[model samples]
Target chain A: MNLVLLFPILIPFATAVACLLAWKQRHVQRVLSITGAVLLQASGFLLLVSVWQSGIRAVQMGNWPAPFGITLVSDLFSAIMIVMAGLTGVTVLVYSLADMDTGRESFGYHPLMHILLMGVCGAFITGDVFNLYVWFEVMLIASFVLLGLGGEKAQLEGTVKYVTLNLMSSALFLAAVGIMYGAVGTLNMADLARHMGTVKQPGLVTTLATLFLLAFGIKAAIFPLFFWLPASYPTPPAPIAAIFAGLLTKVGIYALIRVFTLLFVQDLEYTHALLLVLAGLTMISGILGALVQNELRRILSFVLVSHIGFMIMGLGIFTHLAITASVFYIVHDVIVKTGLFLVGGVVRAERGTYEMSSLGGLYSSNPWLSALFLLPALSVGGIPPLSGFWGKLVLVKAGMETGQYLIVATALIVALLSLLVMMKMWADAFWRDSPGSAAGGSVVSANPVSFESRLVLFCPIGVLGLLTLAAGIFAEPVLTVCSRAADQLLNTEEYIRAVLGGIP
Target chain B: MEVVMSFVIGGLYASGLYLMMRRNILKLVLGIALLSHAANLLIFTMGRLTRGHPPLIPPGEVRVLESIADPLPEALILTAIVIGFGVQAFAIVLIRRCFETLGTDDLDEMRSTDRAP
Candidate 1:
């Protein structure tokens, strides 16, 4: 049963290798990518079911025993993340067949993408801290190449900033891991959590926790460390941007949640309090940044940063209910956020540019695209009456119960403010006629979009939109999984027993 | 000895950060290299400096008795060093390409991607 935990990681690794073998054949690579994604998605669901049935599953790789060896484990949280990664992985891989250019495709785009997928799966399931670091490097190297693949002017510019900042974070992450190992003598997360309270150095753990927060905060695009996000995310094409937008920061947030709930809980008063403050600031700053952007992708990028705060808000509150809400927020945000970016691509496909000033009459010309765009814009950013509402609602309720009314109020106000930004987007992009095409002529100045590409773009949006609605309308099942995942997180003994084995 | 190495590590980090803050892309890449080197050394020092013990154990023993120098951090640093080398290599090539295309080595002019569109 523990072997089932390896399937998510292995499938993508195998798929990526296959893609590399067919490097010269884009057609074969595309077919292989989709098949691999489907297999990955299937494996994710299987792993989730296995975890559901068996509680927590762990497998140790190579020769060492559990604590000293590299272990792969799946609890509810890891399984759910794998499943979500698979979902977006499939949609974006399918969407890329239409969206990515031939110039980019010739340069091993499919193989790098699968490697990225494998890295993500590896990050989600790894049970050791150093192993997690290695997986992160995998994701980073692939993303670095992907971000700079086409070597366009804007892309190179974006890649420079993106590379420098993320490398800083990676260095800090390494230092923190080293310090933790020095202090604890183990890199296994379960062992670290078990031994964290007994460290001889009095204030070292707090400092290490702060170091982790900084490292992951940069990755997750929290408040001060987030400029690289808006700087780079807009440079990539829609499908690439969508995958990065949907999945990348969430990995950082996942690490933050994992480390805080498990390894850093001893100093909650200092660490978690700081987290709460940062969450509020991230919410305010991100949306405020969005309000000034005229570009469709740029606006969506800022909104992505803003809503990342809501997920952190759940983690900051640090209660079972709050954690459950955070997990649900992650699921909702991943589906909705990826959909929003893909829709931005569609809007660009319809018009000539991503600039809202140049884009208009989309609703009148192509109402289907307009409606699909609305599904995500109106859904997340804590907007009411949609998939995003349940997460925020529970978050606010949890915050109120915890007597953290300031952050809760900030959360509520940010919700309304984000709604205002989304409305402004709708008015600017869909409601107004183009400045020149006000007389109802379509403003598709770019090359005529092919039917296959159109299908490629809209299908992902439709599927994500449906998933968003289903997550909203059928909130019970998702919420149950989230709540149980939260329970497993807050209570790590089962995880410890699974990974370390034969212990209380 | 640990204290002296700590200062050395601190100095490396300081210079690394100083270089990273420079406008020249070359300097920035150099800074990244310095920073990664500092991190690797920090890991090396933190693993506790025991000279020439050579983590090998005698055949009769089940384990290296009396606490042989921990070998894990060396392995960790090896991995980090390789990853860092790859990243720095990519960064150097990227700088060349950026210079060829963007026509500037200064980080300030690279703000076209960040400008309000």
Candidate 2:
């Protein structure tokens, strides 16, 4: 009877429908979008608080009993994720006020954004695997429209690769779900988790696990399956790109963690070992790719891929501490990466380009912007008293405690390399003069941002930066929550009982 | 009958994969459509074919009186088919837009974003 779980999802969906209805009226759409975003954030907070007090909450849609109907379950992990997602939705929607043009808005940008949020929240809170696939499609369709809305040549090109690859992943995902249903005759994740142990054919289950890995791996942008990310992420507007950077691939990682930990743990050694190898390669390839990129967003995109490696590394280690670290890192990364991408938006606004070579002297020109950028930049590089540093410290410690010295060393090296990439971006975009500017070419914008314009853009980045700092300084409470979340995820019996009500 | 359905599904999958790997955008869309059908068929076959019994229980009955076809797979396939239709329609429109905007259907040439100065 805990109807609070439905609000975070339904509010956004209702907002999206309202936005579409008011599509001809820009102000009305904006009001609905903002109101929806605020409501979503509010309900998300409520969900998290309730879940924090109560162990886990489950709601059967239409009052249908579990295993026979759609179930929405919220544990600490999902509740926290939904709250973080709500935060991203609110901040990015606000930022979009500055970043998105009326052309895009008139073309249904607000509705699509709300729909995207709905899909993201739905994925986080869903208790069924097939429901997750449906949510994935919801997200995919919205993202496709968002990416290609501008219809710029670059956007179209990027959308093609992005759409094609993502659709293929969807097909793979659907195929896997079909096979899984055929095998177990159940779609509820908790029930499947309970049934997997007695499924009689462990090998088929293992094969299905690998199939899911490949499917979610592509979504999460793991190595060898991540080419579509760098090719597409940089093509959209700043707000769109920032939200994508913040949430889309992470949704894939979330799916990976859920399925691997819940339904596929019977063959942990095999799957996790495979995860460890991919993590090392994802870290290495991503940083190396970033080292060579010159565009700020492109470089950030590569680093984004690399950071996914660290999260996966924790999952690979698979201890209570490691899972806790991964959860913390996910929260930290979502905030910092979104902040970094907003900084990218600022850079794009200040100098009409993402090319670091074409940009320079931002530090001197706008020290406030530089300060905003530096916090997340340095934090992402694992500087102490910054959020990324704490996540990295816990992950590396988890690695060491597990006697994974090579991965520990690789994690350390990746941290250093990440710092190097961040500094390179700083040196090129903020400190050094733009190469074109140095040559007296047209590097700076002709029309400088107005005070009002600056306020619109600066608020989101400043809030995100402050949050990052706060998370770092007040790391203890967040860690306790994360550790408890990890414990709940590992304790599947609790989840199954919560969902099924002892029916089994 | 099971073997025949299996071959049909396998053939559809092979053709779908071949078409997806093509350089043309239109073929890619067709490939996706083919794959969706294959997936639906696979689900149907996996649910096990039954002669003509619907999974309906008689009115006012607490349970089904006799063995019947599994209704779950049909429900799943129906949903998948609808979703697949939407995705395929979107894909076609996207390719058309890409072609109109970028003036190319060859996947190899859709590299405007990937290019360097």
lDDT of 1 by residue, A237-272 (tens): 888899899998899999999999989999889999
| Model 1 stretches with alpha carbons more than 4 Å out | A439-442, B57-67
TM-score of chain B of 1: 0.89
User: What are the per-residue Cα lDDT tens digits for candidate 1 across B10-116?
Assistant: 99999999999999999999999999999999999889988778688878987787767778898899999999999999999999999999899999989986895
Docking class of 1: high
**Which residue window of length 10 is worst by lDDT in model 2 chain A?**
A438-447
lDDT of 2 by residue, A333-435 (tens): 9999999999999888888889877788888888999999999999989998988999999999999998999999999999999999999999989999767
Residue pairs with backbone overlap in model 1? none
Real A-B contacts recovered, model 2: 0.69
Model 2: how far residue B96 lies from native, Å: 1.0
True contacts kept of each: 0.84, 0.69
The Cα local distance difference test for each model comes to: 0.90, 0.91
Interface RMSD of each: 1.0, 1.5
